[model samples]
Target: MQCTDHTVSLDTWKNIQSLGIQCKRTTYRGVRAGWRKQVKKHTNASPPGNVSLNPPSPSVNLGVINAQSVGSKSAILVDSILDHKFDLVAITETWLKPDDSTADFTPDGYTFTHIPRVSKRGGGHVTEPTHYLGRMLDLVISREGESILAHTKVKERFSDHFVLACKLNMNRPPTLKKIITTRHLKAINITDFCSDFCSSAFSTNLSEITDMSHLVDQYNKSLTDIFNMHAPAKTRTVIIRPFSPWYNDEIREAKHKRRQLEKKWRRSKLEIDRQLYSEQRHFVIGLMCNAKINFYSALINESANDQKQMFKTFDKLLHRSKDSPLPKSSSDEALANRFSDYFIKKIKTIRDLFPPTVTSTCIDVSTNICLDHFTLTTEDEVRKIIMNSPSKSCSLDPVPTWIVKEGIDIFLPALTHLINTSLQSGSVPAVLKEAHVRPLLKKSGLDQDDLKNYRPVSNLPWISKLIERVVSARISDFQERNQLQECYQSAYKKRHSVETALLRVQSDILSALNSGDICALIF
Candidate 1:
């Protein structure tokens, strides 16, 4: 939330530019030696008006971003987009790896097609030396789980360049069309109309009723005669009174006592929650301090060579100070000052780089799918960094809705797992270990060894403490350990209530009891 040095952005941008590799926009006429192309041709003809064959409007409304790039590099771009919450992203100029025989589907909840690009075998201008296949662009889509309705690449105005288009069968709402025709109505006579003939024609008829009162009457008389024949000479009637108010009072008191007992039992189960919030605060502070120190040390180590050069410069200046024919101009002093500022600035820049803002923004690809973009920076990492974080911003552009729907179902779970792993282990995920984290660091031109050495201390002291506690308890047979763990769990629940509804309800009672807020109500 606070920053002492904010100007390190200049250096940060410089590192990013120097180290990060930018993907090229390539369009090939035919297949290259190492790439493969899977064709997704469109079946629908061009529609009337300027309606795009691959409509992007629907996808755009779902927060899909329209993008275009070349080849499997485009797929990598999708990975980046998936990392962020983009509803949809489109790529152009795709050059699928020629030798790749596997399906063109992106593993992360995204589906795509590699338009087969074929070429001539000869060494002429159109064809590459080894590959005889042609080149084709693909439509990468994430439409939840829906299939693409159409994907086509059409050449523009006889040009060698092709325009790739894809339409997803995302089962959108339907439109209506109206039809008009003539029909004849039956003719009516004036006299029939005057008699209300039309109303009579449609009236309900009650002419089929049958009588049943005679049978009922005869049965009732026969029953009365039978009863009279079996009647005794004398009959007696008895009445019983209800209990007194005192008896009722006792019953109510007993019920009230039972309610009180239930309430007491509920209260007994409500235990104390003991989570060291103050300790966690200290832990966070220690972790930050350790991280800052490590970062400073690494920076100092990097600039050691620079400092040595400065000393040499100082020595040279002193030697020249005595024999200078004309005194060194004030310009020289200014220049020297400038150089010092620059190097010291470098130190601060490196220090600024230590903290990064960490945030996850979910980009809705469709109604059912979303892309969670995880961003990591020192200062912003601890907070809930939403899409509108000050350091970063996003917009919902037009992407094929199909891509939004299909993309997350394929990609989100894997990404979610990666996020959970990163949170739990405080380490980068293995699957994308090299691709995502290493490449970014490398792109920044940072020293790998220094970065590795400067790794942030893990914030999970409780975990280590717990392990020790468990082992010690096991050796000593300490039942109190179980009690402690239970207390810890209770405290954890109080501190971290489940975000989900059902989970919150189930844990609410226990959480209230643990926090010692359980109130008994008896009536």
Candidate 2:
């Protein structure tokens, strides 16, 4: 035997050798007309007397056939293989070319390696009738005589070609199988939780604690205790399967119906049953396609205003996996310490760039622009701020933002006093300053295990954010009155954004063109 055009892979060669076949590389002469006769002579020859046809041991069943063309006959081929319980299969005369993929013809739980006759259109030998026709054009050969048992011709015809099933006295080698913790927030009753919070000492005795640190600590502890009582955390081992964003209940039911119909068709083998199964299969396919379309359309519509969310939606659609896990060499504590050291060193390096002290003398200005102290917050102002803020919370928060908003009226007085106390003392409580810092990947397509590829995202306590908002509002008001803010700065200003900045640039360019002045922009 000679192989010319395509080379068999080392793994495939090893598999062939394991079956007791000896292969050697040889130059291929052009196909001769007598090559078929020569192959037939060799295939029909008897094995040596020393070789045993059947060994008293467990063995593997293998099948071979001439597919002629496997493209449209893959389904039939798969069914025949399953019915025969063939451990492996070798196909011939597949009529495949270099450009064709074997994956399209390969069955599930099986893989294929093809060495197409690339040099010519068709050139193979013939055998005894294993086909509907009187002659068999397909051949199955084994190097070791004992490896090829008597070929039993299958009664079923696969695309006008018959299968040669054989049992080999060779043993097949044996092949070698995230817990998440989440709180049951859905089980919590908002009404009962609010009533319980209102009755708690943290609410009623807020005025008794004058110390800011003690007040903050008690606030955290009380809210956590109440929240945990209502919705406790649970841990379970969950199977991580491929995420199908569009797979919902409706599609699941359709798929279940399709499977039932398929089973019925296979069992009954009736025309009506087959037709019903086919129709159901098509229906399920259509349902899945429509569901996927609707899912993406809705996602696009909802994320129209949010570019970050829009990008995330694109990632979902593209089926991009999350960042790789952190390196396993370091323990959790060690990783945290390393991150802290890196950030600290980075801060110190930046600080080192500046002088230790400034020698410039202070100059007094005559303008009456001053923001020495922040005014104490009123209950109304505090309520407005809480209501207007986005309902987002950090894990560090004693309660979720939605829960706080839900019980705002009950929480108003104490929250109002806390804000006023902070403003009066011109200091934030230590507990409120604490944040849950999570290291997030800076962007996609980066080495996630590297510390440099991540940035720390700090989620501060809700009350701390509220106080910061109050201070920001006061500073903004002072800036507006004194015109201390830069005129060209569009970010972090009300009703101002990247769009506004772009519009300003466009207007300036247009004005420059109208005035016959050349405008050069620099990044």
Candidate 3:
């Protein structure tokens, strides 16, 4: 049969089969690194190592590309991908309408591919579709030490949308396969391989494009178009889910229920299907969260070198966001502070699971000394505490600033205590002036003028300056109450300490009395 862009002669069909076998072998038992690394050793030349390389042995990474229709947003999304060096990027709704005036795709340094959409016929003039009738998908891939080898289109089911796929030539041919159907196998005089993959029952929970037939038709049509053209001898077809709605609420809930049932049947048939295996064809299962970065290794497995690297990578990815709304009160300020707290927690969790080796120079920031001064008792203790802190779940935004504001109240005391104990800088004024403090004020919806009435200490000259802004009248009363409460708390703590000390002194006096007074009375 003729395939897309080329005739699938017997030789071609054999080639596809061989490629598929090679892929299975490579994925299951290939060398630790990649095909290029072996080539490099043979060539006797080595370049700087790319840290992003997933040392071979069945690991897949998943990332999302939020490229907006506008060129500016697309550039930002592309930059983010390049910076992170993600393994796979599931791009969403790329409004790429190809026409004479526009290029079909743009790959940059990456090899690009897309599934072109076939225009659907309208029933009448009134039924005509606007803009474009067909859906297309674009996939771009780049491999270290490889030229942009394969950039082309294949018709594939991505979701409801078409999927475009690109794979850098890792010295392996792309293999597209079709499951032999019962009818087809009978007609072709074949048997064993026709075992029903659909009724496997083991595959029921797995998500796929709801309409598999439509996807297959798209693939066949694209194959025809590709075969009609004279292109590379190696080009083959693949079926990639156009997109996955795993993040959708309904799907997630359903999966959660399934997971619960699976847990109950752990010792039975479910265990076999649920066990982590390289054979799982799903991208997330097959690649992204692999053995190298398993859940167990991420949490407790921390060595100094690995911990350092994990933090470094995390810090780089934590790019500064645009300015948030200004907070008007201390409550608002606390909410702003929660953003970093939450982000840092996420970093810690991921790092705990997969402790990547990190390095640091002696001349790095001198902030380690400050960790002890905060509410954090010790720099080391702060790791798990801040990482698992409750503030991690709060979202910082102007519209729902209250959520962040509320979380800050819960987190700030813990954070403040940690900072106070570990990194004791008497410069409370300076600390409050930092970016973290500013965001809190903006979110609190309280004005500086409102804070003036709460001054418990007139001696601190900076207190007056903070109260000058009249943004929120409510803050004045709240701050006043807070000051009074703090004063009472301070007094109560001092009183308790003094009473305890006095009691100890009195006990010592009683001991002395026992040693002397009885002898005197007897005398």
Best by TM-score: 2
Worst 10 residues of 2 by lDDT: 30-39
TM-score order of candidates, top first: 2, 3, 1
- Model 3 ranges with Cα > 4 A deviation: 1-161, 164-285, 290-439, 442-523
TM-scores, all models, native as reference: 0.16, 0.65, 0.18
The alpha-carbon deviation from the true structure for residue 399 of candidate 2, after best TM-score superposition, in angstroms, is 1.3
Question: How much is the lDDT of residue 510 in candidate 3?
Answer: 86
Which of the two candidates, 1 or 3, achieves a greater TM-score against the reference?
Answer: 3
Question: Best candidate per lDDT, number?
Answer: 2
* Local accuracy of candidate 3 as per-residue lDDT tens digits, 90-153: 5554554443111212223243433323453111111101111132222233355644323222
Once fitted onto the true fold, the runs of candidate 2 whose alpha carbons sit more than 4 angstroms away are 1-177, 301-311, 321-325, 359-364, 446-450
Model 2 Cα shift for residue 293 (angstroms): 2.7
lDDT scores in order: 0.32, 0.69, 0.33
Tens-digit lDDT track of model 1 for 1-523: 3323223343453464478642222334443212222233222223322223456434331212222223323232332333333333333323434565323224333345444446721111121011111343223333333434333322111012222333443543333333332212123223333233113321112122112232223222332333233331233333222111112333345434434433332222211100122233234334434443454456556657787645654453232222212213367566445444554576689989875875758564444322233232221222222112222111111111222222333323222332333433444322221111111222233453332222221122111222233234343333343332344233333245435444646577677788999745343
Ranking by lDDT: 2, 3, 1
